[model samples]
Target: MSTAAERTTSPQPMNPDEEAFLRALGRVMTLLPRAIDADMMRDRQMPLSEYTALMNLSEAPGRQMRMNELATACMLSLSGMTRVVTRLESRGLAERVKCDEDARGLNAVLTDAGLARLREAWPAHLASVRRHVMDHLEGADLAAFTAVLNRFPL
Candidate 1:
């Protein structure tokens, strides 16, 4: 077995190429969301997080999903999703309803207004996505990249 000191030691330095790759990944992770959110806000639409929550709800069966499930789908914490849903509710885009299968559980249901809002926002969102991300992938092996990304643990 390894000694305690050895186990607690810092990991070896990454090679130059590995370091460069990590740096680039970090930059993308930090910048991508801000860039997209900026574009959405510039167009007077909701921020990316809210937009994402709406999109996920729209895709759910019956246009409704349990709050916790919606949070997971949106890759947000329950509290974060609650805040987003609250904002959505204020805008008449979504509403919380008791889950039919489980009365104690609450579901976020997309309303007609919500669908309309999503439809209105779709064009701007599409344009932003293209400009910030898809356009850059032109002529690249997207399938390969997708395969690699799919390997990541959720």
Candidate 2:
């Protein structure tokens, strides 16, 4: 294995095929989020981020998670996650609670309203996933696809 210094200082140049592949990957990454967001906004009146927050909370124990943990799960900063939760709270979809184990920590809990919103949004979200991604993979091995995607660094 190459040392960190060697890896950083002697980085390999991308060949033409690799360059093409990277470009395609970049496009998909860029476009997919926008497409998902648009679908959610149009059909459910919720942003993708809000839907993501609700989904994460719904799957968590007690339908709640610490703000920082939820932030990490949503790929957002703690402050950003706080804002998202605040919005949900305003909508009566979620609420913040004091963490029993840690005074300094707060948890975001999904409300019944939040669960109902999630139920309503599920169809649109699933449709977006199928239309934009899964539907294209006819006969493709998903395990292989997942494995290959996981090999790349974030």
Candidate 3:
């Protein structure tokens, strides 16, 4: 039922500047996962998922996290966390234990070797984080970005 003039009365199309901003954000998103995977593999001798799980454990108060919490933080499944913990256990980096609060729950605790490895890998990871994401932004830009990201739909 709409004609050309009616369509013209609708809201304006996206401005070119807005389009360019979208394109740049797309490129940034595309670079992140690949770059993280590459850098973690090269410098840490670990895959991204494993590295993320270890990082979460390292940052925990006691270098331990419930497997369910780890799964949620790492955006993985419980079964997937089991496999990752199994791999870390095989390498003497971490182990699973009965949760003190919940008899049926499990916790992944980082071993001494795992903590050492996290320390060793921290510099490279921090450098990459700085170079790729933080180095380019000023405080205002970062704040604005944080606000915008907060507004996004989960």
Give the top-scoring candidate (TM-score). 2
lDDT (CA) per prediction? 0.91, 0.96, 0.86
Span of ten consecutive residues with least summed lDDT in model 1? 4-13
What is the TM-score of candidate 3?
A: 0.76
Better-scoring candidate (TM-score), 2 or 3: 2
Candidate ordering by TM-score (highest first):
2, 1, 3
TM-scores for all candidates? 0.90, 0.93, 0.76
What global local distance difference test value does model 1 have? Answer: 0.91
lDDT tens digits, residue span 1-154, model 1: 6677876795557899999999998998899889989998889468998889889988998999999999999888999999999999998999999989979999999999999898888888999889988999999999999999899998
Instruction: Write one digit per residue (lDDT tens) for candidate 3, span 9-56.
Output: 985577999999999989988888678778878987877778788899
Q: What's the true lDDT of residue 139 in model 1?
A: 95
Among residues 3 or more apart in sequence or in different chains, the pairs in candidate 3 whose N, CA or C atoms overlap within 3 Å are: none
Clashes of each: 0, 0, 0
Residue 59, model 1: Cα distance from true site in angstroms: 0.8
TM-score of 1: 0.90
**Per-residue CA lDDT of candidate 2, range 1-154, in tens?**
8899998999988999999999999999999989999999999899999999999999999999999999999999999999999999999999999999988899999999999999999999999999999988999999999999899887
Question: After superposition, which runs of candidate 3 have C-alpha atoms over 4 Å from their true positions?
Answer: 1-27, 138-140
